[model samples]
Target chain A: MTNIITICRKELKSYFSSPIAYLLMAMFAFLFGFFFWNAVGYFVSMSFQAQMSGRTIPMDVNEMIIRPLLMNVSVIGLFLIPLIAMRLFAEEKRSGTIELLLTSPIHDMEIIVGKWLAATILYACLLGISALNILFLFAYGQPDWKPLLIGYLGLILQAGGLLAIGAFISTTTKNQIIAGAVTFGACLMLWVLEWVAGYETATWATVLSYMSVVRHFEPFSKGVIDTRDLVYFASVIFLGLFLTARSLESLRWRS
Target chain B: MIKVEGLTKRYDRTVAVNNISFEVEKGQIVGFLGPNGAGKTTTMRILTCFLPPSEGTASVAGFDVLQSPMDVKRHIGYLPENPPVYPEMEVEEYLTFVGRLKGIPKADLALRVREASEKCAVAEVSKKLISKLSKGYRQRVGLAQAIIHNPDVLILDEPTAGLDPKQIHETRDLIRSLAGAHTIILSTHILPEVEQTCDHVVIISKGRMVAKDSVQNLTSRLRGQEAVAVEVTGGDNAAIQQRLEQVAGVSRVVARDTRDGRHSYEVESLPGCNVRGDVARAVVESGWNLHELRAVALSLEDVFLELTGAGQAAEGEKQ
Candidate 1:
């Protein structure tokens, strides 16, 4: 456990010390901020029109503004997660430091987990920036903090699932550009799987849609914590990390 | 101690290390000498647990590399051909991370990093970013990380590869100082380095062990068929050569034209014969002013070329 933390600490330090981390953070914050502003503006226009028409429809701030914003954060994560995870293993291999890690006494699983944890933390920091944008909604309007917390929870779970897959893909190559492009392709495919449910309701189509990470995140985005969704995200995270460990083991043989 | 038996590493169609075996006693510095692509790096990688041998076994400090790699890793410090360093990290931070990876206790981590930096002479640049440092400083930083935990064995591959001559001398000295406390296996193709630093040398050619012996013994073993060079002046060249060949145990004599009017002859004697005294006496009795006469012992360079050249010739014929 200490070995894992030691690796995690060093990995995190490297991320922040490079220009990549800050560049990622700024891009995520700017994009998420744009989505937040649009959601708030749409919500205000709807409330003003409803009031002028003398309608008594009650609009919940959490439902009207925060939910769509959380979903937007998830979409933005599809682009951002690849950038964060691409360097985890690819940089190590390119720089020849993989030799140091492989020949160290630490287990392969520890190294994988440490690197994944560091990438996840950076993703969380990105999410935290968007969360600050949501804080303004709480100060003025009467928004329920509980559902906002659940929406952010959904964003994190979704990010965790995608980042793990990106981490696994990063281990397959030494070129960070290739790693990033392939991971982006994979995350896009996962996001587009839900379109299969719209076209056909066949058993195969349903299975494909069920595998889409977006489906599992729906309940949490609506302020409902379902154990089934938790299990799905947990399974995805486990499968991704398991594959990463196997990749690292194969690297020992092929090196 | 280190032991390898019939170790082989094959990458697809090419065999990098083929059926090589050797041993290193405790507290001995063994030089793994071979040309580029001759499997020196492959052998070191196997012992360091970076890769497993495709066949046979290797053990370091009583732990089999394939069976108990973590144990073997715990006992060995390895520096690959290129120094593995994080460009963004300061030297002290890099050393600290490697120390922790080597499982040094938290309390002793700072002290160990300091000691390692001082040993490798990178203490003054401890705060500088690694990418900003010069190549020699970066190489020393790599060495500092390897020795941060002070393992029982050190496996250094081309540790002095890209350094200047003074840095190479200092690195060799540092490696020599580490002897008697650590069993080190340093690999290089430079002949004089092995002669100057290593007590024992294991020469490999085409992934096969060609020779393994103490440095002195390897040279002396090839000294039996050595040549003697004689320089004489103020005599007819043909008469001088004729008289030199008449010495006891002299088998063949070849004379070369000299620019300064001195007659130079390379005399080959029968195996195991010491004909320097006889050649000197014969030249003196002939009234030729003998300027220089000495039996030329085979240098390590000659022995290395002869052994590897034999392997190349065999390979050529097979192909």
Candidate 2:
């Protein structure tokens, strides 16, 4: 446990020391805040509201403005997570530090878990900053804490799954650019699989659509946490992380 | 102590190290010498447990590399050809990370880091980022990391590869000081380094062991009878050569003359023969003015060339 935590702390320090983390965070925060303010103005302009009681606003109005903004933030996170996780092993291998780490006393599982947890933490920070929309809406209208919590859980789980996929892609090659591309390609395929499933007419296609990250996220966004949705997200995260571990194991022999 | 028997490593169809066997006693500083692409790095990697041999077995400090690799790794400190460094990290942070990775106890970690920094002469650069360090400083940091845990065995591949002459001398002195405490296997192409530092030498060529012996012994084995060149000013070249050849125990004599009118003869004799005095006496008796007489000593380069030739001849015979 100490080994894993040591590796995790070092990894986190590396992220902060690098410029990419700061650039990604600044871009994510600015874009999401700008889109949310624009969304608020658009939704209010479309409403036919006269000067009502100063203290009252429709509950659905805040949801209408905040949901699209937060959902867009989630979409942005899906792309940015790959950028952060791409260097986890790819850069290490390119620099030959993988040999140093693998020959050390630390277990392979500890190294894998440590790097994955670090990437997940960075993704959480990005998602956490975007969650400011919930607080922004609460300032003007009564907001449901239950739905917000559920949605945040879903975001974290989905980000964990995406980060594992990125980690797996990183182990496949030593080039960070190729790793980033492959990670983006993998995530983009899964994300678009649901849209592709929409065109099929069979029950299996509907099941495949249910496997999409979006389908599990819908229940959470509605403040309804179903056991089935929880199981689906958990399974994806587990399989992704398990594959990542296997990739690292194969990497020792490949090099 | 370390032992390797019938260890072989193959990449695809090309063998890198083939059935080579060697052992090192507890405090022997062994110099691993080979030409480029002679599998020194591969063997060191296998010893460090960074690589597993395709066939055969190896053990370090009584732990089998294939069975108890973690224990083997715990006992060995390895410095690869290129120092593995995270350039963004400061030297002190990198050393601390290495100490922890090597499983040094938390209480002793800081002290060990300091001791290793001082030992490798990297203390002054501890707070500087790795990217900002000079090549010599980076090499010192690499050595510091390798020894921070005070492992029983130290493996350094090309430790002085890119250093200036002064740094090379300092590193050699540091390595000499490390002797008798840690068994070190340092791979290098510099013959003089082995002559100056190592107690035993292992020479490899084309991924095969060519020779293993002490430096003095290796040179002694190749040392032939000493030859003296003598130039006589006023004697018939043939008669002088004939007289020198007739001297007891003188095996052969070849005489050559310059266009400017001086004759030089090379006299080769058997071991325990000092024919120089005999040649000078003969030249003076023959009423010839002996201009110059000098004896030549065999150098390590001659020994190296002889071994490389032997290795090549053996390779040719196998083909």
Candidate 3:
């Protein structure tokens, strides 16, 4: 446990000490704000049109503005998650500090979990920007607090799954650029896999569609909780981290 | 403190270190002498638990490197050819991180870092960024990292590879001071460095053990014969050379350089012979000037070359 914290602390320090963390946070904040502005503009203009049409209908602030806005935030995360995890193991290997870590008296799991935890925290910090924008809604109007919290929860879980995958990819190479580009490609594939279900209803198609991370995330955006979605995210996290541990073990032989 | 037996590491079809075995006793500083790509670094990696041997076993501090690597790692410290330092980190911060990772207690972390930095001569640059420091300083910082935990064994690969003469001297002093508290195995191609620092020497060539013995013993073991050189002037060079070769128990005499009034000759005597007195008496009695006469013992450089066989032909020509 102490080894985990030690590695985690050092990983976090390296992240913040370089320009990578600040640059990632700033870029994420700008893009998320732009998406939030577009979502709110469309919602406000539609509300005004309804007022002029003499139709007494209600609009859900959560569904109209926050859901799509959070969805856009998850999209932005797909791009930035690669950046968060690319340097975790890749940079260490390039600089030869992997020798130090491997020779130290720490278990391989401790190092992997420590690095994954640090990446998850950085992803959460990026998600915090969307929460700041959500706080603006709470200040002006009545948005149901439970659904917003659940929406944020779903976003974090999705980030955890993708970031774990990125961490695993980072271990396979010593070049951060290759690690980042490959992780982005993998995450994008996971997002578009739900399209398989649109045209076919076969068992393989259904299974592949259910494997889509985006499919699992859709229920969370609708402010609905499901056991299957939780299980999906948990399994992805476990598998990604398990593969990372295996890659680290195989390194001794390959090198 | 360390033992390796029948260790072999093969990468694909290339065998890196092949069937080599040696042991290091406690409280001794052994030097690993080898040419480039001689598998010295590969051997050290196996001992440090960074790589596993393909065919045999290695143990450090009573733990097998393959079966109980964590226990071996806890007791061993290593410095590879390149110093493994993070450029973005401060020296003190890096040492503290290594200390914590090596399982140092929270209460003792600070003291261990301080002791390590001072011992390695990196105390003054503790707060400086590593990338800004020069290569020599970076090497010293790497040394500091290895000694931070005060492990039972230290495996250093080319520890003084990039240092200036003064830093090399200080590092040698520090390494000597570290003996008895820590058993050290440092590899270097510098022969004189080994002669100066190592109590025992292990020579490897092309992944095989060529020679392993004490520095004094290895040098004396060359040819098992005593050598003497004599300088005589104001005499016929050929006649003096032939006369010296006739001395009792003298095997051969090779003429060396000659100046205006002095000529040097290298004379080799048979095993268990003392012909220095006989050679000196012959030169004086022949009415020629006897300038200098002394026995010449082989240096570590000659022993290393002759043992490794990398430059054996050239060494033979020189002799």
Candidate 4:
């Protein structure tokens, strides 16, 4: 456990010491802020038009602003997660430091988990930026915080799944550009798999849609904590990290 | 102590390290000498648990590398050819991180880092970023990381590569100083380095163990096939060559023209034969003034070339 923490600490320090962390945070915050402003602006204009027309339609701020904003944050993560995870193993391989890590007393699983944890934490910090923007809705308006928390939970789980996949992709190459491009391609495929369900009703299409991460995240976006969605995200994370461990093991044979 | 028995490593179809075996006793600085692409790095990687052997077994500090690699790793420190280092980290921070990775207790991490830096002569660059330091300093920092935990065995792959002569000397001296307390196995193609620092040498050629013995023993083993060099005045080149070849135990002779009407002949003798006395008496009987006659001993360079060159020739013939 201490060995894992030591690896985690070094990985985290390396992430922050380079410009990758700051660049990722800046890009994520900027994009999420744009979506947040647009979502809140549309909500305010709709509420004003309702009040001016003498209609008392209930406008739940959680549905109007928070849910859409959380969904938008998830979309932004598709691009940001790849950037965060691309350098995890690629940089180590490029710099010849993988030899040191592999030859050390630490287990391969520990190194994989340590790096994945660091990338997940950085992704969480990106999600926190959008959460800060949503906090303003609760400060002045009468928005229930439960659904908003649930929405962010979904976003975290979803990001964890994607970052794990990105970590696995990072181990396949020594070039960060190739790692990033391949990770983006894989994430995009997972996100768009649900479109196949609309065109076909076959069993294969149903399985494809079930694998779509966006489809599983819908319930959480609407303030529901379904066990199936949680299981889906957990399984993806587990599978991604497991494949990463296998990839690292293959490196010993190929190195 | 380290022991390897019939270890082999193959990458895809090419055999990187063939079935070879050697051992290093406690407190011995053994030199792994080989030419390029001779599997020096591959063997070291297997011993360090960076790569598993395709055949046979290797045990480090009494732990099998394949069965209990963690136990083997705990007792060994390895420095690869490229000096595995992170360019973005400061020297002190990098050493501290490696110390932690090597399972050094947190309480003694700082002191261990400092001691390692001092020993490797990298304390002056402790605060500097590794990318900002010179190549020599970076190598010293690599050495520092390897010895930070002070393991029982140290494996260094071409540690003195890409350094100036002065830095090479200093690195060899540093390795020499660690000889008594630490069992060090350093690989290099430089002959003088092995002659200066290592107590024993294990020379590999074409991924096979060609020679393993002390430097003196290896050279002395080839002493039987030694040649004699003689310079004489007032003798025809052809006549001198013929007369020298007639000496007992002398197999062949070649004559060369020297300055001031002198002739130099190199006399090749049979195995275990001392023909220097015979050549001198032959010169005196011929009434030629013998200027010089001495037995020529084989140097380490000659032995290395003879071993690796033979391997290369055999490989060339196969192709």
TM-scores for chain B, listed for all candidates: 0.86, 0.83, 0.87, 0.85
Q: How many clashing pairs does model 4 include? A: 0
How far residue A163's Cα lies from its native spot in candidate 2, in Å, is 1.3
**C-alpha-based local distance difference test score of model 4:** 0.90
**For model 4, how does the per-residue alpha-carbon lDDT over A134-161 read when each residue is reduced to its tens digit?**
7787788888888878888898899889
Candidate 1 Cα misplacement greater than 4 A, ranges:
B224-297, B310-319
Q: Report DockQ per prediction, comma-separated.
A: 0.73, 0.54, 0.69, 0.73
C-alpha lDDT score of every prediction, in listed order: 0.90, 0.83, 0.90, 0.90
Q: Show the lowest summed lDDT stretch of 10 residues, model 1 chain A.
A: A126-135
Tens digit of per-residue lDDT, candidate 2, span A1-255: 888888888898899888977988888889888898898777666553533444445547436765666567667877898899899999998988887787787788788888888988987787677777657777877766777777777778778888888888898888999999888888777777688576896888887677677766766666678999778877877787788788887765445
Candidate 3, A1-255: lDDT as tens digits: 888888888888888999988999899889988988998899889989999998866888898988998788888888999999899899989988999999999999999999999888878877886788888888987889887778888988998899889989999999999999999999999999989999999999999999888898888988989999999999999999999999998888878
Runs of candidate 2 exceeding 4 Å displacement: A48-58, A131-134, A203-211, B224-300, B310-319
Q: What is the TM-score of chain B in candidate 2?
A: 0.83
Per-candidate TM-scores read 0.90, 0.86, 0.89, 0.90
Q: How does model 2 score by TM-score?
A: 0.86
The deviation in Å at residue A32 for candidate 3 is 0.7
lDDT of 2 by residue, B1-319 (tens): 9999988998888888988889999999999988889899888888988878899899999999989998998998888877888899999999999898899999999999999999999999899999999888888898888888898999999999999999899989988888788999999989899989998888887788888888889878746667788888876777888888888878888665554567897788788787888888988988888899998676565577677775466546755
- DockQ-superior candidate, 2 or 3: 3
* Comparison by TM-score, 1 against 2, better one: 1
Report the lDDT of model 1 for residue A63. 88
